[model samples]
Target: MNTMVWKVDKYVDNLENNPQVVDAANFLRKNEVVALPTETVYGLGGNAESDEAVAKIYVAKGRPGDNPLIIHIAEREQLKQFAAEVPALAETLMDAFWPGPLTIIFKRKEGVLSEKATAGLATVAVRMPDHPVALALLKSCGLPIAAPSANSSGKPSPTKAEHVLDDLNGKIAGVLDGGVTGVGVESTVVDCTEMIPVILRPGGVTKEQLEAVVGEVREDAALTDEAAQPKAPGMKYRHYAPNAPLFMVSGTAGFLQRLVEEKRSEGLRVGLLTTEENVSGYDADLVLACGRRGELETVAAALYDTLRRFNQENVDIIFSEIFPNTGVGHAIMNRLQKAAGNKLISE
Candidate 1:
C-alpha cells in the first residue's frame, strides 16, 4: 500500500473542513485504516462498525485479534449509540477526563460496533481525544473509530508522526500528521462495567487522579497477575519494548554504573536508560536521558521515544533506572517494566 502523508497544523481552526482531514476521513469511510494523532499517542484507526476495517487495523499493527481496540469519538452523544449502560461514576469521569487521556470501558450494546474491534467482549473501550486534529477527523469520519497505537505490535507506541511512518509505512492507508502528541503514553484505561470502576492500564491519567474524581478506584488484578485475563488494550501484552534486552535496575546510580561496566567488560555494547540528572554519571556506549526524575510527567512523555532510540542505536543490552511508582511515575514504571519484560535487578 502507498501510505500517503498529510501534514496539518496541530492548532489549525476548522480542521473538520480541512482538505487534508477530509481526505483522511474519506479513507476511513471506505474502510481503510489511517494513522491520526491523539493527545496521548498516534492511533491506527478504522471504521468500528466494519469487520473488514477493524481486521485491517489488527493486520497493520500485527496486533493480536483478541486484544481490544479503543473506540474514538468526537461527541458525547455517540456514547449512547454503542454503550448499553454508562454507570454514574463513568459519566462523572467522562465529565472530568474526557477530551483528555482517559479511556472508559462500558457495557456494550450488541450489534452496534464490530465484534472484532471489541475482541468479542461485552464491553467497549471509548475515549474522546483532546487534540483538535483528532476531534476534527472524528467529526469528519462521523463513525465510531476503533484504533490502537499506530506501531508494530509489542513495540513502543508512536508519539510523533515520524515514529508511525517508521513502524507502519506501506502497511496502512495513510498518516494524518498533526505534529507530536502531548501525553507520551497511551490513555488511562478504566473499566466502568462494574459498580466500582477498575483501572486496567496506567497512562497519562494516574490512578491518584482517577481516585480523586471517582473515589475508591480499584486496579485490575491482571495488571500484576499474569494468570488473570486482561480486559483492556494494553494490559495483556508486553509492549513498548526495544530491540535490545532491557533490565530495570533498582538501586543507587553507582550500583547501576557497576553493572553497566560489567556488561561492557564482557564486550557487550551496553546502553543506559536513565534520567537527565544521572546521564552524566554513567559511562556506556549510549546513555540516553528520558526527561528528569523530579518531574514524572516528562519521563512519561519521553519513555517510548527513548526506548525507540535504543533500537536505533542497536545496543546489545539496556539497563534502565527505576522510578518511584507515584502519580505519573506509576505509568512511567509500567511501560519501563513492560519494555524490560519485568527483568529487574536490585543492588
Candidate 2:
C-alpha cells in the first residue's frame, strides 16, 4: 500500500483548526493505521479496541507478539473505560504526569481493549499524550488508540515524521507530519498492576520522578532470554537499534578517548555520540555531541536522530558516552545500551 504523507505545519496549530483530524479519525475507525507525533516519539496508531487494527500495527512494525502496545487517550477521565481499576497511586501519578511522557500499566477492562492490543496480557499500558496533535486525533476518534513507536521494529524509534516515512513508508496507511518529537524517546512505562510499581521501560518520565509521586518505584532487572517476553512495551527485545553496530563508552573521558583511539587504529569507521566536553579530544570520522554534562534533555532529543544520521552516513560502528543515570538520562542510557547490543562496564 502507498503510504500517504500529510505535512501539517505547526501540528498543534493546524490541529486546532484543521478538519484533517476528522478524516484521520474516520480512517482509524475503519481499522487503518496512522502515523502521528507524540512528545516522546512518533507513533504508528490504530484503534485499540479493534483486533484487526491492532494486528496491523504488529505487522507494520514486525513487532513481536509478546511485546505489548501502549494505548493513547485524550484525557484522564477516559482511563476508566480501558482499565478495570485505576489504583489510587496510579491515579495520582496520572494526574501528575498525564498529557506528557508517562505510561501506566493497569488491569485491563477485558472487552474494552482488544487482546491483540495488550499482547493477550491482562494488564494494558495507557497514557494521555501531551502532544496536541495526538490528543486531538484521539478525541476526534473517540476511541482508545493502540500505538508503538513509528519505526520498523528493532530500529531506532523515529522522533521525526520523515524518519517514519523512511522506515515505514509503504507499510502504513498515512503519516501526520507533526515535525520533531519533543522528548525524542519513548514514555517511561510503569506497571501499576503489581503491588509495588515496577518500571517496564524508561523514557521521558524518570524513576526519580515516579518515586517522587508514589514514594518507591523499581526498575526490572536486566533482561534475560526468558525475560524478553515483555509484559509491557520495550521490555524484552532488541529495540531502538540502528543499522550500524553501536558501542557504549564507559569510564572516564581519558579512558573513552583511548578506547576510541584503539578502534580508529584498527582502521574502523566510527561514529561518536558523546558530550560536547568529550568530543573536543576524540578523533572520529563522524562525531555528534548531544550536549554538555547534566544537559540530558538535549541528548534525549537528539538520540534517535543521531542514530539515523550515522546509519545514513554508513558508519561501521557508533560509540556513545554513557550519561549519569538520573532523570531523562536513565531513559537515554536505556535506549543507547539497547542499541549498543552489549554492556561494557568499567570498574
Candidate 3:
C-alpha cells in the first residue's frame, strides 16, 4: 500500500472542508486507516464501526488485540450513538474537559461500534480531541473513529507528523500531517461506569485537574502495581520505549553520572536523559535534555521526542533522571517509568 502524506494547515478556519483533510477523511470513510493529529498525539484512526478498518489499525501498529482502542468523536451529541448511558459524573467531566485530553470509559450500546475496537468489552473509551485537524477529520468522516497512538507497538507515541511517518510510513493508508502535538502524550483515561470514577491512565490531563472538576477521583491500582491488569488503552503493554535499553535512575545526579561512567568504562556508548539545567552536569557518549525539570509540562512534552532521538543516535543504553510524581509530574513519571519497563536503579 502506498502511504500518502497530506499536510493540512492546522490554523485554517474552515479545516473541515480543506482538500487535504477531506482527502484523509475520504480514506477513512472507505475503511482505510489514516493517522491524524490530536492535542496529545497522532492517532492511527479507522472506521470504528467497521471490523476491517479496526483490524487494519491493529496490523499497522502491531498492537495487541486485547488492548482496546479509544474512540474519537467530533461532537458531544455523537456520544449517544454508541454509549448506552453516561453517568452524572461523566457529564460533569465532559462539561469540564471535553474537546481536550481526557478519555471517559462508558458502557457501550451494542451493534454500534466494532467489537474489535473495544476488545470485545462491554464498555468503550471515548475522547473529543482538542486539535482542529482531528475534529475536522472526525466531522468530515462522520464516523466514530477508533484510534490509538500512531506508533509501532511498545515504541514511543508519535507527537508530530514526521514521527508518525517514522514508524508507520507505507504501512498505513496515509497521514494527515498537522504539525506537532501540544500535550505530547495520550489522554487521561477515567472509567466512569461506577459512582466513584477510577483513573486507568495518566496523560495530558492530570489527576489533580480531574479531581478538581469531579471531586474524589481514584486511580487504578494498575498505575502502580505492575501485576495488576490495566483497564485503559496503551497501558497493558510497554509503551514509549526507545530502541536502546532505558534505565530510570531515582537518585542524585552524581549517582546517575557514576552509573553512566561505569557503563562507559565497559566500552558502552551510554546516553543520559536529563533536563536542560542538568545538561552540563553529565558527561556521557550523548547527553540529551528533555526540557526543564522545574517545569514538568515541558518535560512531558519532550519525553517521547527525546527517546526517539536516542534511537537515532544508536545509543547502547540510557540512564534517565526521575521526576516528582505531583501534578503534571505524575504523567511525566508515568511515561518514563513505562518506557524504562520499571527498570529503576536507586543510590
Candidate 4:
C-alpha cells in the first residue's frame, strides 16, 4: 500500500466531519489498515470483524500471531454485541474511565470478533480512545477496529504521528495525524474474568487509580511469567529496544557515574539517561534528561523517544538511573527492563 498521512490541526471536540476522516474511514471499510492517533499512542487499525483484515496488522508490524489486538469502539453500546458478561467492577471502571487509556478485558461471545483479534482466546481487550481524530474516525467507520501500537513489534511504540510514519510508512494505507498524544504510553489492560481483577499490562492508568475505582486490583503474574503464553500485546516480547544495548544502573549515584566513566575510557562512546535534577551532573559522551526525577509521568512519556534518539546519536552503550518501581514508574521500568533485555547492574 502507498501510505499517505493527513494531519488534523487539532483534537478539538464537536468539529464537523472533514474530508480526510472520510477518506481514512473509507480505507478501513475496504479492509485496509490505517494508523490513527489515540489519547495514548498511535494505533495501526483494521476492521475487527474481518479475519483477513486483522491479519494484515500483524504483517505490517511483524507482530507475532498469538499477541492479541485491542478492539476500539466509538460507543459503549457496541460492547453488548460481543461481551458475554460485564463484571460490576468493569462497569464501574468503565463509567469512570472509558474513552481514555484503559482497556477492559471482556469474556467474548463466540464468532463476534475475528479470532485473530483475540488470538483464539475467549476474552477480548477493548478500549474507547480519548482523541478527537480517533473517535471521529471510529464513528465514521461504523465498525469496531482492532488495533495495536503502530510500530514494528518489539520496537518503541509511537506517541506521535511522525513516529508512526517513521516506523510504518508504505506498510499501512494511511495515517490520521492528530499531533502528539496526551498519554505517551498504551492503555492499562485489566482482566475482568477473575474474582480479583488483575492488570495484564500497565500504562496510562495506574494500579492505584484502578484500585481506587474497583478495589483490590492486582498486577498479573502473566506479565512476568515467560513460560506462559502472553495474555496481552507487549507481555512476551523484547519490546521498546533501541539499536544499542541498554543497562539499568542501580546503587549510588557515584557508583553509576564511575561505571559510565570507566566504560568511556575504554574507547567506548557511552550514553547516560539521567533526569532533570542530574542532567548537568553526568560526564558521559552524550547525556539525555528524561524528565524531572520525581515526575514518573514525564519520564514515561519520554522513555521510548529517548531510546530511539540514542540510535541517532550513535551511542555504543546506555546506562540509565534506576526509576522508582511504583505508579507509572512500574510501566516505565517494565519497558526499560525489556529494552535492556534484563541486563541490570547493581552495586
Model 3 C-alpha lDDT per residue in residues 37-129, reported as the tens digit of each score: 999989999999999999999999999899999999999899999999988899999999998999999999999999999999999999999
* Inter-residue clash pairs, candidate 2: 99-130
Off by over 4 Å in 2: 11-17, 223-233, 345-347
TM-score of 2: 0.93
Candidate 1 vs candidate 4, lDDT winner? 1
Candidates 1 and 2 compared: the better one by lDDT is: 1
Where is model 4 more than 4 Å wrong at Cα?
12-16, 224-230
Alpha-carbon RMSD, each predicted model: 1.0, 2.2, 0.9, 1.6
Candidate 1 Cα deviation (angstroms), residue 183: 1.0
**TM-score of structure candidate 4:** 0.96
Lowest lDDT 10-mer window, candidate 2?
A: 222-231
lDDT for each of the candidates? Answer: 0.92, 0.83, 0.92, 0.88
TM-score of 3: 0.98
Candidate 1 has an lDDT of: 0.92
Clashes of each: 0, 1, 0, 0
Model 3 regions lying over 4 Å from their true place: none
* TM-score of every candidate: 0.98, 0.93, 0.98, 0.96
Residue-wise C-alpha lDDT for candidate 1, range 226-299, written one tens digit per residue: 68887675576798899999999999988999999999999999999998987998899999999999888888
Off by over 4 Å in 1: none
